[model samples]
Structure formats: structure tokens, C-alpha cells
Target: MQLVTWNTQWCCGLDGVVSPQRIVQHARALADFDVLCLQEIAVHYPALEGNAGHDQVALLRALLPGYQVFFGAAVDEWTPDGQRQRFGNLIATRLPVLQLQHHPLPYPADAGVRSMPRMCTVATVRDPGLGAVRVMTTHLEFYSKRQRMAQARALRVLHAQACAHAVAPPEASGDGSPFQSKAHTPHAVLCGDFNFEPHEPEHAAICAPAGADDSEGAPLGMRLWDSWRLLHAAAPQPPTFRLYDRRYGPEPGSCDFVFVSDSLKGRVQRFVVDAATQASDHQPVAVSIA
Candidate 1:
């Protein structure tokens, strides 16, 4: 299975043009992805840089036929025209979606710092090579360090929760009830714009083992292995943001990543970053798993 993750910046390219079609085209040029995870997708929010309030979810769904689109809006509000405006993460999968969930990450209020609510979109899909697997994409708080750390902790908690549920799923009805059993696998691929540099403490926090108290007796929490490190070892990670656009700062670094559960470590075949695409301020990272 091939998976790609990118922060679209609402589809605004380096030329200051916001085109969902171009974003799709650029990602397709990178790889024939079985799953695509996009962050910073806006809906009916024309105020964003170069955005014209287009429903990016619908546009992406239309562009990628036969894919199931799942959106998790971290910032949801009603515009002056009574239309809904949402901004958050998106997951598009060609695989069969067995279950879908939206998890709102920790967003402790910090009046001094400007930050928005963050969320992770989780989907359990049936992959031809890996069978049932959990996939999640998220965008963490950018301006608030405290919030970002909290959000990272929340992600670890979520992973442990999923594993617990997978081990002891709820009882199902014998009759053809609406509440049928769905596939839930401990193996997962967590990818997205983490909003923190690869060397930051938040990155290490994410990879740290969960405490025994946090796991609820389901063994030690599953460790998430960085796909890049597993494949490249001592090599320095390529820049994924601020490569050309320096709106936030001049220094370029990698803030986007793809992490697979320890169970799926050996299955990680390849990891590549499309550094040439200017379709968005951030580059796309693709991973091939067997």
C-alpha cells in the first residue's frame, strides 16, 4: 500500500494561487497512493490566504473518484452568509473504509498565544497487503507550545485506546443488527503536519513509550516507529516546510512525517518526499508498505 501526507495550506501554491486541482495533480505525480492525508483544508473560508471559500473536500472527492473522503473539522463556524466554514484535516482512501472517527485533540486555552483547535481524522481501512489497519492524520497547534505538547500526549492516548478496543471489541448481535462488527487493527499509520521540527522535544514525546497507567494493562503502549528513520537511519531528514516560502521564518525544516506502529515496521518498504512540487508551501511525503 502506498500512502501520502501533505499540508495543502488550503491549496495555495508558491505562486499564491489556491487550486485544489493542482494539489491533486501534484500528489498524483508523486505516487499512485492508496491513501492521501491532507491538512489545512478550508471550506467556505475565503479569508484564508488565496482561498476563495471553496469546499475543498467536495472538490477532492470529485477529483479522486472511487475514494472515500473523510473530513475532521477542528475549526467549525457559521459564516455571515449562514454557510458553514470549516478548517482541519482530510483523509481520502481508495481502500474499503470499515470505520471512521474524528478525535478532537487537547486545546487548552492560552490567551497570550494565537492558536486554533486541532483534530485527528482516524479511519480503519482494509488494505490488500496489510489487511485491516488504522490510519490517522492531524494538524497540531502551531503557535502554542503548551497546546502542541498536550495534543501530542493526546495522540498517544488515542493510540492506546484503539489498541485496547481492538483487543477486546464489544459483543456483537447475532441477528443482522445495524451495530455489526467492524474491523479494528492495532497496526496503524500516523501521518500529517506535526507543526514541530524533527529535532524538537515534541517529536521525541510522540515516539516515547506510553506509561503503564496510560495503557490500561494492554501491555506497554505500542511504539510508533518513524518511517524515515526506519528506512534512512543516520541520514538527515529533508525539509518539508519553509523550503521556499518564508512567511513564518527563513529557516527550513521538516515538520511533516509518517509514523507506523511497531508491528508494521518491517512492512515499511519506501519513504520519499516530493521536494520539487510547489503546489503548496509544504512538500508531500509518501510511504510504500507491503
Candidate 2:
């Protein structure tokens, strides 16, 4: 399974911020991903942006056929110029999307920024080639620790749901929910800008540290594992963010990543955070898992 995660900056790069064609061109060149998760996709609904009021999500779906696309709007607002726009993350999958769900994180009062809601989107896929997998995309609050903690709890709750749903009976359950009974914990691939490092508490709640050596030199920790660290191993320069913007991290940078569950870590044969890419402010992370 090939998966990708990128913050398109609403496809605002190179020439202009609202160039839809640039978004298509650059993202297509990024990778041929089976499952793609994008953040900051500027989709202006009710009133369109650019020429024909082209919906960014529609354009991407048109570009990549056969694959399924799902959008979760985090913030909806009206522009001063009198157009209403929605900015949020996107989840597109080639595998059969059996179920789709979204959750909005709660923001605190002291945070001061209650303008937009942080959202998480998940897609449970039934693939003919690779069995079944769940892919999720989300953007956490960048400024508030309180909001982020709340966001983390929201994600954990959603993660637990995905795990439980993966094994649900294919036939409708007693409550009318449909899921397969024999399914397992569901191979999940979480992609996005977590805004926290591997050792950070936020990271711990998401993809728990895995594949690292313990005191007994054994590979053990929690449930989820960092796919980036697993793929790169001990490469000296693994900076993803500093590849374009030089002033983001302290000693160079590397913030973007693709994290997977421990059960699927070995399935990942390739993982690359595109540092040299000029399409967006942050580099894109691509991972191939079997």
C-alpha cells in the first residue's frame, strides 16, 4: 500500500496562492499514492475561487480516478471580498472506502482562537489486493497546548473507534452498524503534520514509540510507531521541513512524517519526506507498505 501526506498550503505556491493547476501539477508529481491525506486544501464552496469556482476536492478526484475522495472542513468563513470559503484536510483512497467518519476537536476559552474547529477524518478501506486498512488525516491546533491536548483525546477516541469498527460484522450489527466479524485491529496509516516530535507527549498519544531498542535491546514500546524513523534508520540528515524553509527548526529541521501501527511497520518498504520539493512550505512524506 502506497500512502502520502502533504499540506498543500491550499495549492498556493510558486506563482500564486489560488492557482488550481499548480496544485494539480505539483501534487501529481509528488507521488502516485494509493491513499493520500492532504491538509489546508482551500475549497471555497457556495462561492468558488479562481475561474469556474472550481472545487479543489473535485479537481483532485477528477485528476485521480478509481480512487475515493473524502473531505473534512475545519474552518468555514466568508472572505472580506464577499465569498465563503472552507479550509480543511482531505482523505483520498483507492481502496474501497467502506466507512467514513469525522470528528471536530474542542477548543478552550483561554485559547482565544475559537474561529475554526480542528477536524479529523478517517476512511476504512476494503482493498482487493491488500485486504483491509484504515487511513486517517487530521490537523491539530498549532498554537494552543490546551486545544492540542483536547485534540489528542478526540483523536484517541476516534482511533479506538476505527480499531473497533475494523472488526465489526460485515453484516449489519444489532444496532444496524455494518462491519465484518472476523476482521482484526485494522491496519491503520495515520498521515498528517502532527506538529510534535517523536518523543513529545502529543506524539506518544498518537503513534506511540516503537521499533526502538529497549534496555534489553528488544523492539518494544506502545501501539503505534513512527514510520519515518523506521524507514530512515540512522541517516544523518533527515530534515524534511528545512529542505525549503531554513528558519523553522533549530538545527536544520524535520517535522513532517507518516506514522503506522507496529503491526504494519515492516510492511513499509519505502518512506521519503521530500525535502527538495518546492511545491509547498513543508515537505511531503511518502510511504509504501505491503
Candidate 3:
């Protein structure tokens, strides 16, 4: 299966043009992806540069027919005119979805730092090669380190919780009820614009080993491994953000990453970053599993 993750600056390119069609065209040019994960999707937010308050989710859905598009709005609020504005992440996949969850991440207060509510969208889909696998896409707090750390730790806890459930599933309900059986899998692929460099503590926290915090004592073994490292070995991950556009920073480095759980590490076949694209401020990262 081929999956690609990108932070489409609301589908606005470096030329100050907002076009969802361009974003879709660039993604397809990179690879024939079965799943596409996007961050910073805007809806009803015309204030964004070059954005016309277009419903990005609707546009993406219309553009990619036959693909299931799921959106999780982290910053959902109302304008003075009562128009609802949503900004967050989206996932488009052709795989058969078994279950889906929109998890609102921690948004602790940080004085004098600009930040927005964040969330992670989790979808358990049936892959042709990997059986049931969770594809989680998210965008974390950018300007605040405290909130980002908290959010990172929270992600580890959530992964642990899901792994525990996969080990010991809930009671099966024969009746057609809410407590019926659901697709559960420890195998997961967590990808998105993490907004933290590889050397940062937030990155290490997610890759850290599960310890006492896991009350269920689920033997998940080690935590997530960067898919790039799994295949690239000693090579550093190519820059994903600020390569084409240097307004964010002078030095180019990667803030976006694709991390796979230990169970799926061996299945990671290819990991590549499209560094040549200027479709957005960030480059698209693709990973293939077989």
C-alpha cells in the first residue's frame, strides 16, 4: 500500500494561488497513493491568504471520486455572522474503512504564544497487504513547546490504549447494539506535520518505550519507529517544510514525518520525500508497505 502525507497550506501554492486542483495534481504526480493525509485544511476561513472561504473538505471530496474523505476539525468555531469555521486535518483513502475516531489533542494554555486547537484523526482500514491497520493523521501546536510536548505524550498514551484493546477486545454483543464488535489492530501508521524537528524531545517522546504510564500493561514492546530511519538507515530525513519557502526559517529541516509502529516496521518497503515540489510550503512524504 502507498500512502502520502502533506501539509497543504490550505491548498495555496507559493505563487499565492489557492487551488485544490493543483494540490491534487501534485500529489498524484508524486505517486499513485492509496491513502492521502493532509493537514492545515481550511473551511470558511477567507481571512487566510488567497483563501475564499472555500469548503476544502467538499472540494477535496468532489475532486477525488470513489475515495472516502474524512475530516477532523480541531479549531471549530462560529464567525460573527454565524458561519462555522473549521481548520484541521483530512484523510482521503480508497481502502475499506472499518472504524474511525476523531481525537481532540491537549490544548494547554501558553501565555503570549499563538496556538490553535489540534486533533488527530484515526481510521482503521482493511489493507490488501497488511490486514487491519490504523492510519492516523494529525497536526500539533506549532508555536508552543509546552503544549506540543503534552500533545506528544498524549499520543503515546492513546497508542498504548489502542494496543491494549487490540490485545483484549471488548465483549462481543450479538445484538445489533453500540457495543458490538469492531475492527481493532495494533498495527498503525502515524503520519502528519508534527511541527517538531527530529532531534526535539517531542519526537523522542513518541518513540520512547512504553512504561508505567500504561496501566493495562499491554506488551506493545517498543514504541513507533520513524519509517524514514527504518529504510534510510544513517541518512537524515530530507526537509519537508521551508524548503521552497524560507519565511518560516532560514535553515531547511523536516518537521513532517511518517512513523510506523514496531509491528509494521519490517513491512516498511519505501520512504521518500518529494523535495522538488513547490505545491505548498511543505513537501509531500510517501511511504510504501508490502
Candidate 4:
């Protein structure tokens, strides 16, 4: 199934289509995606230059008729008194959603240090061909490295639990299959702005198998694997962040990523970083796996 993960920057761009409309346009552009994971999807925040923003979930549901919508709101508050300012990650899928979990990531050691709170939303998508699989999306902490590391660790834990639950026991299926031996695990696609460069030391732990010890030498329970490396089997040399647009040249790569379990590496058909697009400060990323 085709899948896309993009950070639209609340759809504030030169197109003037507005956040809701941009979500629609972008979804339409990606035509046949089985799953679409989005970050920075604002509901009440207006564009940087256009009309007042509309409900992103409602608008996108219209754009993607066959897909079911799931949103994880990171913030729900008003600028002053009554206005609502809600924004967070979103998951749209054509696959049947068996269940979903939205939880806050781990915070840094120094709680008082101050940083933006982040969240990771996990969704169980049912594939008739492959049964059920986990699809997750999250925007990592931007300012604090400690927080990001902790968040990454927490994400792994959550992913392992969700994945464990997704598998249907042979007896539960009523097929009367005697033994329930799991020889191979299914796939889990984790996408979003990790806020860390590719191959960064902090991510070494996240990229490791579930329950492996981290860089700190402490035991980590849930091992979250990297789908990119699973598919590529290697990290691309140099950085993958900022891009020189129509105005500038090659800048630096910032935050963006797609990770999956090691077993499904060969399934990745292609991985593209569309940083040249003017849709937002960050470019869109698409990964097609069989």
C-alpha cells in the first residue's frame, strides 16, 4: 500500500489555499495513498496570509472520501479567552482501523528546563493481505535533546505494546489452528519530524531492536526499528534536511523521518524527500513499500 508522511507547517504557504484546503489539495495530489500521516495540522489557527482556518479533519475527510480520519490533538486552548487553538498529528487511512492510542512522549530529565510537549499517535490498520499492522506519527521535541531522547525511548515502549496487541491469536481467530508461533513480525511505520539528523547518536537507541539497551547503557524495553535502514540497510551519507529552493541553494536538513521494523526492509520500494516544494518550509516525504 502507498503511504505518505508530510509536515505541512499548518499549510501556510504562497499558494494561499489555506490550511484546510492545502490538506485537501495535497491529499488529492497523492491520489492512491492507503495511509496518510500529517504533522502540524492546525484547526483554528489562520494562515500566515489568508482567511480564518477551518477544521482540518472535516476538510480532509471531504478530500479523502474513502479514508477514515484519526487526529491526536497536542494543544487545545485559546489565544486569549474563548477562541480555540488546536493543533497536532493526524492519520488518514483507507485500511480498517481496529484501534488507536494517543499518548504524550517522555519528558527530559530536567523538567524545569522547559520545552514543547510532544505526542505520538499509534493506529492499528488492518490489511486483508497482511492482517493488522501499526502506523505511528509524532513530532519530536525541538529545543531539548534530553527530551527528544526520552521521548524516543517512550515511543519505542508504546510501539512494542501496540504491535504485540495487534496480532490476532490463532485460537482467537476461531480457525482451530493449534499452535500460535509467530515466526515473523509484521510492519510498523513511524513517521514525522524527529528533530534529529539521520544517524544521530540519540536515535541509535530508537533505531535499535525493541528491548535493547540504549546509548546510556540502560535497558530499554520496546525496541523501535528503522524502516528506512531496514529497506536501505544503510544510512545515506551527509545530512537530509534543509533544501535550496527556487531562491536559495542547498541549505541544511532539519527534522523528518520514516522508521519501520527490520524485518520489512525489502518491502520499501522507494523513499523520496521533496524538500524543493514550496508547500511549506519542510518538504513532503513518501515511502512506497510492497
> CA lDDT of each candidate?
0.88, 0.67, 0.89, 0.69
lDDT of 1 by residue, 153-256 (tens): 78877877777767778786556676777675788999999989878888887887754554433457576778999999969789999998998888889999
Greater-TM-score candidate between 1 and 2: 1
Error of 4 at 48 (Å): 5.7
RMSD of each: 1.5, 5.7, 1.2, 5.4
Query: How many residue pairs of model 3 clash at the backbone?
Result: 0
Using all chains and alpha carbons, the TM-scores for the candidates as numbered come to 0.95, 0.78, 0.97, 0.79
Task: Please provide, for model 2 over 109-207, each residue's C-alpha lDDT reduced to its tens digit, 9 standing for 90 to 100.
Answer: 644554357888878787565676767788877667777777765565555555544445345444544533434444777778766655568866665
Candidate 1 wrong stretches, greater than 4 Å: 174-179, 215-217
Q: Give the TM-score of candidate 4.
A: 0.79
Error of 4 at 65 (Å): 1.3
Give a tens-digit lDDT track for model 3, residues 1-290.
89999999999889888988988988888879999999999999999988749899999999999899999999999999899999999999999999999999999889999998999999899998899999999999989999999999888777877887788899877687888898878899999999999899999998887654656355748478889888988688999988978898899999999989878999999888898888889999988988
Candidate rank order under lDDT? 3, 1, 4, 2
Model number with the top lDDT = 3
Which is the leading candidate under TM-score?
Answer: 3
Superposed model 2: Cα runs more than 4 Å off: 14-17, 45-54, 78-83, 113-115, 165-185, 209-222, 234-237, 246-252
lDDT computed for candidate 2: 0.67
Off by over 4 Å in 4: 14-17, 27-31, 47-52, 109-114, 163-186, 213-223, 235-240, 244-250
